[model samples]
Target: MKFNWGNQHKPNLFTLLFLYFLIVLIVPLGLFSAYYALAGNTNQERYLMRQAMNMTTGDASTVAQALESYRHKAYQLSTNPLVVEILKADSLEAESSQSRKLYELLFTVMHGDIYLASANLVSNSGKVRVSTHVFPEVDDLRYHGNDWDMASIINQNSQVSPTASLISIQSHRIAENGRQVVASILRRVYDQEGTNLGYLVVDMYADALSPQVNSDHVLTDMLLVDTKSFYATSLVHPERFGSFDRFPALNTLDGNYTPRSLPSDTSIIAISPIRGTGLHLVGSLSSAPFFQSMENWLSAFSTTMIIGVVLALGLSYLFSRSIARPIKNLAKRMREVEQGKLESREVSSAISEFSQLEHSFNVMIKQIISLLDLTREEQAKLSEAERKALESQMNPHFLFNTLNTIKALARLHGEEDIYTITVKLGKLLRSSIDNRESEATLEQSMALIESYLTIQKLRFADKLTTEVYLDPSCKHIKTPKLIIQPLVENAIIHGLEPKVGSWNLSVRVERAGERISITVGDDGVGFPPDRLPDNLDELANSPHVGVYNVYRRLFLKYGRKLHFSLKSKEGEGTWATISFPDEEAIKEEMQ
Candidate 1:
């Protein structure tokens, strides 16, 4: 057979196979290689920076625990009644004896914690009344006005009852040497009558926090900085104490772990604040080691990817041949089927999946023919059922009775207005019996209400008066049919029928924001408060069927998108309101 080279229906299988191989293998590999080359180094750096932050967070937690323990112990010593009495003594002899007793108490408390350098009870007169160390250094300590500034160090706002104060960390000068760091906790002492006696100070050496804040990694270093931007202690450079100009950005961070890039030596710094002490633990790590590991990983990955590409090319050729052969055979069979040759020989293939495809095509054609016959039969049955349903809904007896009543009214009254009312009554009865559609425009529903009220006005005469107020903008909105009529009927029967005097009924429709509300109110005998149901479920089994029917229909049609309410007072009045969202109508208008 001769091949038609210009035939648009025929495609060259070899060319199609090569294009498939490129899309399945080469394109994806090229995209992945480009992305890896662009983002590999940046992603690795972010991961390493996160690791450094995690290390600093763990170290900071340990230091915060240790400092909190010291604050609790200091609170106990400061509030002791004996210590307060000693600071308030009148005579020198009484003061001397109480001072000895206070010294014994301090020694017993400080015996377990060797890191505590000194504990002192300083009187308001600027005298060291009691202390763990005799002749402790107190001259260099700064005082604010008549009170020591150290008194503010204790956390006075602690949530614990009898609020414990915070421990303040400060650098104190020692004689003949440089300033040494100390964690000072101070609380004011009060007498039994709530009199201010003096202040208590507990000093802990800052060196005690060195081990917890120190990092063992060779490329990493840690430092502890106080809230004043002064170095409390340093594991890397001890001489940098009292100076924080090296890390100027350290003061800006809060209690969370934050990472910052350093210009010096291309290092990354992570800092986390220590709770209760107003200090931060800063960790720094050099980026050189992290970059070296990334380079090594890239070299090994590139070699592996090269081998993978070579293997993929060889396998792609074999796979393309296997897929292309079956597809070519299937296409030829499809062209035969297009020419109306339904009895063609089955197309066989070496591949199990392709063989299954051939079998499925044969079965589908037979099913399509059978379904076409079934579809015609179903259409005939559906049309017949629709006709029967329409016939059953149109009741001839109700229509005949309504027409006969209108004839009697026309003959007996002999009034021209009675003819107009009968015409409206006919329209209302016809609309109610149709039941072809479940929804009508707001205007159509209002017309039905107008016709029904016109007929009722003739029956009740001067005893009944009705008012209707419809917003011009909401006339075109759609609502469930017969919803308003039932509510109006219920209002007439239950609310206004039993009243002795003239009854007034009002129907109002208004649009507010995205919702439309309809209210039906009557100045008649209202419902008793105790007889009304609380919700729709309770209303289902109640005696009020018309109101409950309208509620159930609205709920089923709109779900939670609509609101229905009824309010009444026994001797005053009754009001029924229905509100539904107008979003769908607004959207249609915009379109």
Candidate 2:
């Protein structure tokens, strides 16, 4: 008998040489090509992100410059002898002719901003000497102490360098048009000792500030946010308002551009704060195009390497059949392990080294699977315990007392209406207690809102009217149940219940691309921005707990895709907006 090696045959050398050549030569070249492409693409992406951020910063600076120029012009108007004479006289009656001439001169010379709908000379004693546009009637402009209150200026005891300040210009033009108006100004008049006597109010039409702005695309959209509510005036589209947050890009008070959103994607945001004011100009650009090109090139290189490996293996098979067969079996076992099958595959190779390796891998896989199962069980138990603890935190007795009050009112008034309210309340309580799903369809949420609103309408009777707008596309999308009802309830009890007017509670749902937006607004004495809660925890601790509750649930379900915000001006009304991801995106997130 012929002497037999491990393979029961002698192996040929040519095939092995080819395999070695492919691995050593072709694979190294492929790796180098991949590295070069990725490096070039990454550099390009960095350049693009930088470019966009620079554009936003530049646009913001332009707006700041324009306002600064306007303020300087107003200061120039403030210095005219005629203006000082009118202000010093105290009462217009003392120098009415001079005051009139002074007003006319200032208006003609300094009405430079296209957005400056009107200019005024306001006295501390509640006198508006002049106005550009007369509304309802020109003489109708009478000073009320409230209208003359200039909270925008830090009333110094003496004159100082002029700066642009936010103020309300008393002009009928904006008031009659039902558009909001706020002034960014040049200067305030002062006495010899620098005491503030009056202000040279340069009123800007909020709507007119972006001449091209329309309801659909307000300029407020492109704003970068900071501690204060100022935005990048130039980056904003003419119609989109409050659509972008400067909070992420730049600090309105401190100009900085730090990197944000990377690894998965890279982009840079730059913010430039106005020198003295709480305004930030922000800009952003994505490095996606550059990165995508790099990914494609890298993938092509990987594919070529895989092809070369296959060709080398084909050439080597005959010469290294015993070694190659055992290696191929090992690869198949690894694929099964990777797929989580974690089971032994048949290994009939006669090679002792290969047989030992296969047995060892099988034993390790079994041990890992056993440990993974135990970990999953422990995690499940912990999650269950946490849920039970949180569920017990809600106070049931407090709800009982509030319900008793409803029954007492119904009996005392002899009204059947309270019976209907009690029924709705019971259903609401039941839904809140029992709904177990992390999220529910918008239609289900809307029903919950309707029930809550119905109860509110009966309780307030003549004091409230509720309107609901559900976008046609968003009805079947998923969001946490009870998310909207609490906000509506808060609006009614806190916003409308105390006000005397014909209160209007409006709830609107909208779908935009991948987002589902909900708005709740009320025509009642709005909460002051200063008085609003600072964070979710503060909101929960205060009377606005309902708003906080909705906020918390949103965070729990959607993370960053859910957003909550409030807009308020006292005596005007309050508007609250909430946004969530659309249905398809929400489902993908759940998976």
Instruction: Supply every candidate's count of residue pairs whose N, Cα or C atoms clash at under 3 angstroms.
Output: 4, 11
Q: Please report the TM-score between candidate 2 and the true structure.
A: 0.35
lDDT string, candidate 2, 207-323, tens digits: 444432222331123442333333333324422233235234333323333422122234444445555444554444444555677678778877886787677667555546667
For candidate 1, the 10 contiguous residues with the lowest summed lDDT are 151-160
Q: What is the TM-score (0 to 1) of candidate 1?
A: 0.41
- C-alpha displacement of 40 in model 1, angstroms? 4.7
lDDT (10s digit) by residue, model 1, range 71-95: 6767788788777666677223434
Query: Cα RMSDs of all predictions?
Result: 23.5, 44.1
Candidate 2, residue 475: lDDT: 78
Task: Name the best candidate (by lDDT).
Answer: 1
lDDT of 1: 0.70
